[model samples]
Structure formats: C-alpha cells, structure tokens
Target: MYSKKVKLRFVFVIVFLILIVLTTFTVLKVLKDNVVYFKSPSEINLLSEISNKKIRVGGMVKKDSVMMNNNKINFIITDFKNELYVTFSGTVPNLFEEEKGVVAEGFLNDKKFLVADKILAKHDENYMPPEVKKSLGE
Candidate 1:
C-alpha cells in the first residue's frame, strides 16, 4: 500500500501536469487568434459580425473598373453574385488586368473599400500547371 505522503505527491504531480497542459494550450490558442483567413466577397456576408479583421478577398477583377490616382489604384472584385471595391498602392502583378482573377489581402476600410497590402493574380484554368491539369482531367 502507498503511504499518505506518496498518495498526496501523486495527486499533486497529476494536477501540476494538467495545469501545465492547459497553460500551453491557452498560449497556443492566443497565438493562433492573430492568424487571419481568406474569403470571397460573397463569403463576406457570412462574416458580417467579424468586421475590421484582416483577410484575403478573392474574386475576378471587374472589367473597366480599375481607376488610378497617383499611387493608389482602386478597382472592383466580383464573384458573379457579389462585389467588393478594393484599393491598393503597389505595382500590380504581371497577370493583373481587367476580367482576370485576383486575390487581395487586407482589411476593409471605413469607406467599405478593401485596402489591400498585396494582390495575387489567379491563373487561368486553360493554362494550369501539369499537376493541376492532370487533377482536373484536362
């Protein structure tokens, strides 16, 4: 039979281990909170309650909708059903053009424009990499 001291020590060790695990889990959860997720303009409605959070907006660059002013370029991204205005201040990607797919990363501004820090042009399905082409049976 274990002595009272040994029983007490065993309980203390188990409690200490559980506390350590909980503390580690809490710390990791806090860190993960800073990471943001991407969404389309149509998906924005699903996250209406979570405004002012950083996110990536992916959609087609609206045709004849890009307007330039000094260093800022304002454009509209559309997902066929919904659209969002976007403003970015940087050199556009090589593939960036009207009626092309684009993914902008930033947060929505007070004026409802997506202030993008970067823009990524999406490739066309007709000219995909070999792996993607094979996956789609193209």
Candidate 2:
C-alpha cells in the first residue's frame, strides 16, 4: 500500500527513463546512418558483395598510376596486396600525388573500381608546413 506521492514519483521516474532511452536510440540511429566506413584495397578485394552505399577507401596512390584529362582524374590505390581503380571528377587536394596516402569517398562500382565523389589526402605524423620546417631548420 504505497502512498499516492510514492506512485506519482515512480511514474515520473519511469517516464523520464523512457524519454532518455528514446533520445539515445534516436541519436545512435542518426549517427549510424551517416557513418562512412573506411576500408583498404585488400579488404575490399575480400568482400563477398558490393553495396550501393557510399564508403571510404584509403591506401597509397600507386606510382605513375595517376592520369588526368581536363576535370577528370583516374588513379590506382594500392595496399601492396591489392589495388582499386578510382575515378574522380573534381579538384584534388594539393597533397594528392603518387605514393601518398589518400582516402576517396564514393560508391564502389565493383570490387576493383570506385567512383569517388571526394578525395582526401593524408599526411604522415612527421609532416610539417614549409614555414614551420624552415623555422625549425630540420
């Protein structure tokens, strides 16, 4: 025989917990929908099925595998075990070049080809801007 006050408090606490759980689930669902997973060329080569969803593939640009014609650029990304051909029609980052690390965001046309919408160049941990390098004298 709990008092009326105790029942009211229990109900309020239950409602608050439900709201919290709902909010958390909503946030997680949104995040999951927007997440783009990164995979290497070797990993992609092992996929059993290619999805239409967008993903990011990162690896070193194969040497002399880059070719450009007007706005479109084609290159090969390699992880030393496998390679994925990428075609992008846009301005590329300055750091993008042969033998550099790159992450291309786009949909995979197949296990060996990717149609990239964006290109992101990655630098090593020791990389420093020219100005800073000049100042540091090494």
Candidate 3:
C-alpha cells in the first residue's frame, strides 16, 4: 500500500514528464521546420553560408532578359546589385513577365541557373499579396 504523499508525487512526476515530451515535440515540429526564407541578390551573393538551405529568392525579372525555347523559359533576375539566371519549365503565372517582381523557389545548380521548383510572380503594390509584401519587408 502506498502512502498518500507517494501517490501524489507519482502523479506529479507522470504529468511533468508528459508535459516535457509534448513541449519538445511541439517545438521541434512547429518552430524548427517553419523557417521562412527571404533573400535578395546581394544577400544571396552571400549564399555560401546558406547554400544548402531551401530559400525564397526575390528580384525583378530583367527587361528583355526572358528567353523561351518551347516550354522552358530562361531569364535574369536582378536585385539591382546582382543577377541570377532562372529557368522554369512549368506554366508561368499571369503576372510573370520581363521587368516584374518574381520569387523563385529552388536550388542553384552547378551551371549557376536556378532550377525553380516553384515560381511566384509579385504584383504591383496595389495588387500585392499580404504574404509577399511582408516577405519583401514592405
């Protein structure tokens, strides 16, 4: 037979251990993997530090820089300081065009071209999405 004090202590220990496990799981699942990536060209120039990190790279599609051959489109995105070549084969957004804001999600290949897994077109200020605007720090 256990004393009242021992039963209370056992219950407290079980609850305390459960709380610790739950807190650790929540922090690892939500806080750790929910990182949002933001970058401009000059910032990306420092990519050697975050090169392996999946990130969001934003810049303007250079005017007359977009070239298309079949389903593939190649263009230069510039942040006014640096430029990166981007290649996307999927259907582009309606706003995707030369001299427009674009965010490409992917990794930089050995060829220096961004192999975009996703392409997002940034609209004008009056039409900007709240998330994109916030990402641009606007």
Q: How many clashes show up in model 1?
A: 0
Q: Give the lDDT of residue 10 in candidate 1.
A: 100
- Candidate 2 on 1-138: residue-level lDDT in tens? 999999999999999999999999898888973554578998899888999988899999999999999999999999999999999999999999999999999999999999999999988889778999899986
Evaluation by lDDT, superior candidate among 2 and 3: 2
Query: Candidates' TM-scores?
Result: 0.61, 0.67, 0.61
Stretches of model 1 off by over 4 angstroms after superposition: 1-37, 110-112, 128-138
Question: Can you write out model 1's per-residue Cα lDDT over 46-97, one digit (the tens) per residue?
Answer: 5646577677888899999999999999999998888889999989999999
Q: List the residue pairs that clash in candidate 2.
A: none
lDDT of 1 at 9: 100
Q: How many clashes show up in model 3?
A: 0
- Ranking of predictions according to TM-score: 2, 1, 3
Local error of candidate 1 at residue 103 (angstroms): 0.2
Model 3: per-residue lDDT, tens digit, 1-138? 999999999999999999999999888779653554446767667655546555667889999899999999888889888888888888889989888899998887632467887899987767677899798985
> Distance (Å) between predicted and true CA of 116, model 3?
0.5
lDDT of 1 at 41: 84
Record all residue pairs in model 3 with backbone atoms less than 3 Å apart, i.e. clashing: none
Taking the candidates one at a time, how many backbone clashes does each contain? Answer: 0, 0, 0
Judged by lDDT against the true structure, how good is candidate 2? 0.94
